[model samples]
Each structure stands twice: as structure tokens, then as C-alpha cells.
Target: MTASTLSAHHVGITVNDLEELLAFYRDVLGLTVVDRFAVGGDAFADAVGVEEGRAEFAHLEAGGIRIELVEYDPEARGSPAAGLNQPGATHVGLAVDDLEAFYADLPESVSTISEPRTTESGTSILFLRDPESNLIEVLES
Candidate 1:
């Protein structure tokens, strides 16, 4: 296998609140909802290693990148841990045309890690948590 032969399919994020997270990604971030669906049954349970796997899901696309948001059944769900230093913790980085406008447009309820800052390389980046507390990094393209 080679890197050239591989391409990104999508980033899967597990959320507790489907509607809230969907609103943030779709309405707030302006990502287009490509598709929405629900999954369940014995097959899904076996694949996910859950006794009875079931969930609602949505796929949003932005700049050719797809974000798969999943809201698992409450009975089969676990709480999210905090901190980026933890193992297996993942954050999605997105490139935006206007960093300032993007930051300003974010709702006040959105918890930002800090104000947008430019690095020595001249790339502007900011960090914020989604409705489900998933860390998202927005960078100026």
C-alpha cells in the first residue's frame, strides 16, 4: 500500500446530541449536508462491538472534506473525555478563506480555546469545541 493510492473518505465523530452538532456543523460552519440516515440492527451491533448498535448519522461536506456525525443510542453510548493530550483524541482541522470573519461568526455559546493567532509561518489558526465538545481547529488558507 502507498500513500498515493489512499484518499480520505471522511472523519467520523461520535456525538451525544445529533441535532445540536448538526446545527453547528451545517448552520454555523456553513457545511453542506450531503446525506442523512439512520442505522441499527444485529449487523451494526456486531460491527461496532455493541450489543445493540443503533444511531442517527449525517454527512456534511466542506471543501471536498466529509465529516460524518454520529449520535449513538443512549443505551450504547459513553461519555466523552476532555483534553487533547489523551490517547486516541482527535481534532479536525479545516482551512478557511477568512479567519477573522469565521471567528466572529461563531456563536457566543461556542467555547473557544483562545483568540485566533498567527504563527511564524503566517498561518492563522483558532481552536474551538463543538456542541459535543469535539475540538475543531480552523486555519486560514
Candidate 2:
């Protein structure tokens, strides 16, 4: 239960298009592609808690963290935008060695949301929203 004992494994987000999302994470953010998989038949069906009998997913690694991007078929189920940024919504905050360099390299759309400020706890950070409006925090180390 201590800080040293608590570890973050990965954060998963459902996206509408796998290729587009992969481009953003891979090219724009400079994350490395770690793994990818397409699942179908009974194994996928049971593992994902889905009745579609298939699944598609990719994994990206950046800043020592893993991001899992999932793309399910349109008719498979609900909407991806349904719970984004709601009151109880959760997003990942990543720490960077060079905050200024990271900010400078971001695209216009992503840069626009980089409102740099200091937290009450005295941590320097910049906040931005992804294409999906998921709040992302880049903290200065």
C-alpha cells in the first residue's frame, strides 16, 4: 500500500480507428510500438467479456509506460465517447525529463492545450487533451 509498492502497469483507451490512433501515438508522440494482436473466436470472446467473438488491439510504449489502444467493431457495442472526461473519468499523467522539449515538439492541436502551471503541491506540469479529449498531464521531473 506504500508508494514504493504501488506500480502502474498500463492505461487502456478505446479508439475508433487503430491506424489513426497508432499514428498519433507512434509518430507524433514518438512512442514505440511494443505489441499488437487481433483476436477472434472463442478465446477472444471469453477473454474480453464480449460476445462479438473477436477483438483488435495494439500496445505502445512511451516514457516507461504502456498504452493499450483498442478498436472494436462499430456494431459490436457502445460508443467510445460515452464516458470521456465525465466527473469520474480517469486519464494518465506522465512524467518527463524535459518538459520544455516535449512541449516544443508537440503538434499545434496538442500544443494548444499545454497550459503550463504549478500544482498546489509545487509540481510543474502542463495539461493537454488528446484527440479523444482525454486529459493528459505532463509533469516536470
Candidate 3:
């Protein structure tokens, strides 16, 4: 039987620094912080596939899509080794009104993977990384 009625609720990202990540999403990206809370326990650990899990979480919303940021205890955290060609690597793409202006306003701390470039199809895209090195793409709509 085929499962139906499935939809994305939010994208969860495990972060090393909660405040820094929150500032990037909320202040820099203009997402609204919906809520913040702490979570831990055997149930959560099992669900996350961690032997023991504990974290501070925040929910931010942008253009109706929600992003859940989780900052696990230092001992529980793992190193990030995701590369562009890696199987499990993931990136979020956002549509912007002014790609050039937005690119110009980006903080100096952001490492740009690619400057804004336009394709033959008239779509402009910019690729960059967050402080934690999460890849992000901004496209002109």
C-alpha cells in the first residue's frame, strides 16, 4: 500500500552554536522565531538515534516554512563532514526578490561558494555557507 497525505513539517538542523545560528536565521535571514525550548530523554534519544540526547531547540519560520535548530550537548555533538558530492548532504534554497542586493548585504563572515550568476533560463542563483558551514542557495524569483 502506498502511504498518502505526507507533507514536510519542518527541516531540522543540529547546530554547534544555537545563538549564532538563531541570529543568522532570525536577524540576517529575517525569519521569525516561533518558539524556543529544551528537550531530552530516552524517547527523544531513541527517535534521534542517539544513545543519549539532550538539546536546546528553536523554531523559526520564513515564508511559511519552518526551520528547527537543535543545539545538542557538546559531548553528544559530532563533526560535520558533509561535502557537495556527499550522499547525505543537504542544502536549503530560498527565493529572493533582489539577488544582487541581497548578495551585497551579506555579512563578511559568510563564505561565498559562488557569486550571483544567471543561467540561460533567466534564473539567478547565489551559493554560500553559514557560520557552521551549512550550504545555502538564494535564487531570484
Estimate every model's Cα lDDT from 0 to 1.
0.88, 0.75, 0.86
Q: Hey, what RMSD does candidate 3 come out at?
A: 1.9
- Give per-residue CA lDDT, model 1, range 1-72, as digits (tens): 765777799999888788999999988888999999999999998998777879899999978989999988
Please give the ranking of all candidate structures by TM-score, highest first, separated by commas. Answer: 1, 3, 2
Q: lDDT at 124 for candidate 1?
A: 96
All candidates in order of lDDT, best leading: 1, 3, 2
Which tens-of-lDDT digit does each residue in 1-141 have in candidate 3?
677877889988888899999999888888899999997899988887767878899999868788899898634545656687877888888889999999999888888888899989889999888789898889998
Provide the global lDDT of candidate 1 against the true structure. Answer: 0.88
Clashes of each: 0, 0, 0
TM-score of each: 0.89, 0.77, 0.88
Regions of candidate 1 where Cα sits further than 4 Å from its true position: 1-5, 74-80
Q: How close is candidate 1 to the true structure, as a TM-score?
A: 0.89
Candidate 3 residue runs with Cα over 4 Å from true position: 2-4, 74-80
Instruction: Give me the displacement of residue 63 in model 1, in angstroms.
Output: 1.0
